[model samples]
Target: MLLPRCHRIKQPASRSLFQSRPAGRLFIFMKRIGLTGGIGCGKSTLVDYLIGQGMCVVDTDQLAREALSPGQPAYDTVMESLKGACRLEDGTLDRSALGHLVFNDDKKRRWLEGLLHPVIRQAWESRLHTWDREGCPMAVVVIPLLFETQAQDLFDHVICMACSEKEQLHRLLQRGWSQEHIQQRLKAQWSLKEKMDASDGVIWAEGPLSSTFQQWDQIYHRIVSP
Candidate 1:
């Protein structure tokens, strides 16, 4: 399947302080594992399971949020580009508002990604470097757009979490997402089939939580012992 041209690396913006670096060359000592899946696909559940087992988890979603906070790296640029359409009266970013605009428009979505991905990658690389220096064995990075951003090369291993389409839609509905909104978000990502095909491992997130836990346990042991 042909991915959108946005999935490929583009020329760097000259004024941006953050730049993408090759993860493989930057952190050779630590085992870096990338976790990704479609929206509502239970990637977070797997991330939490890994965290409970004492792995350091770097969440790109969280980092992106931080990057957009008032004084952070991406804040000023976002405000300037979005022209206050996604900002609150009190000067905070209205995430839901921004999400609505971007999800419905491919150009806007790619623009936002172009603004944020470099900053996010820089932050993730910094954390990985710190972990390596501190003698950490492995770190799990939760990036929802790992494959879309062509970030699979950044990790020693990559895991794609997935479930049936029915289950995915149901889960998103439970979280108060409208069916249309969910579909739009899903459309922005690589299909689960493609992600699973490209990944080093796959975790089916269909069944009960205990079943998911058991699958995670097996993967954990394999990563640690193999």
Candidate 2:
């Protein structure tokens, strides 16, 4: 059975950019929800469901990819930072090479984050402002490192998706990730337990598609309704 609506939940304290004033009083406001989870935890699947339900979803990963593309703001800096190690002959980024480099080295990973994070933040904020101006009722921003980047403050509520660690590893392996790469990526983020404890809601993504969708439907109604 689905969980009941959480009527006792408190309103967010900080005002978001989407809040609107009407007749001298605040009225409608867009609820900015952050959906996050570790890599290979099926966040994209949940995001698709939300998009299908008519919620505006701003995927940070998409923004990052754009930012890293040639002629984008982060592209030159990233290539320079990597010292051409991950630059392809066609003047594009070699993602696999870059991934292998940074995931294994703490300093390089931090350096890369430093370069890309500001650009990603700017893009995210810009999109939110656009959606707010368009009067979107709610938006879900997918930030894979929401907690890691200390960006939880940007959302009205957070939903963390989780699965068993064994399942997590298995899923990544199915994606052709090496065991070492999987471990490195996992170690880079906050544990699932930590994310779950900090979030307003949790979605266990260990079961069948129908079950996951059911949970998502319940959570979606709760968030989109009063």
Candidate 3:
């Protein structure tokens, strides 16, 4: 149910709630849509489909990885705060080791979030500004922690991609993750129920890919049409 892109271009929607900079003429034509989901809910796959549809898509997970890579400011701060124990032999942050450390310990988890969230948010905003000027069809940001970080207000619309817990566990198993790893990651965020309650829309990923795309198509039309 997508309105033609030209219709969106001719009659833009109101400015996005997540937009920080001025909604220049270009951005006036673009809408910012956020897609969030838990560890095994298939958000990445949906984002890829959106990108294929000619939308600008940014994966905050990828940005977080970049922000924490060796020599990045975030990398430096994390290593300094934890006193070098979070590093691997190659001097890069041992993400798996760090994950184990924080996932089980509330105190360490808070400290890690305190250090990383601000940096990642800033990076995300920068990318958002850059893309807004490019006059893309629309923009999609994949933020796994959208609700956990209280960033739901940062987008024009927030979509939660969800699945049954049984399906979630099954998906995680397919990824070769241990049951303990799955539960540990899931425990770190707001539960699926909470995420849906907070989002403007919900795309249940338990069905076929075509069904998921159909939901996405409807979302794009709702947001982008003048």
Best by lDDT: 2
Better of 1 and 3 by TM-score: 1
Note the Cα lDDT for every prediction shown. Answer: 0.79, 0.80, 0.77
Query: What's the TM-score of each model vs. the native?
Result: 0.84, 0.89, 0.83
* Tens digits of lDDT, candidate 2, 1-226: 2222232223565655444454455546878888887787789998888788887888999888888899876888887766878888999888888888999999989998998888898888888888876778778889989999999988888887788888888899998999999889889989887877778777778789777778777776777664
1 against 2, candidate with superior TM-score: 2
Clashing pairs in 1: none
What ordering of candidates by TM-score runs from best to worst? Answer: 2, 1, 3
In model 3, the worst 10-residue window by lDDT is 1-10
lDDT at 8, model 3: 19
Count of backbone clashes, every candidate in sequence: 0, 0, 1
TM-score of 2: 0.89
lDDT of 3 at 148: 82
User: How does model 1 score by TM-score?
Assistant: 0.84
- Looking at model 2, the pairs that clash are none
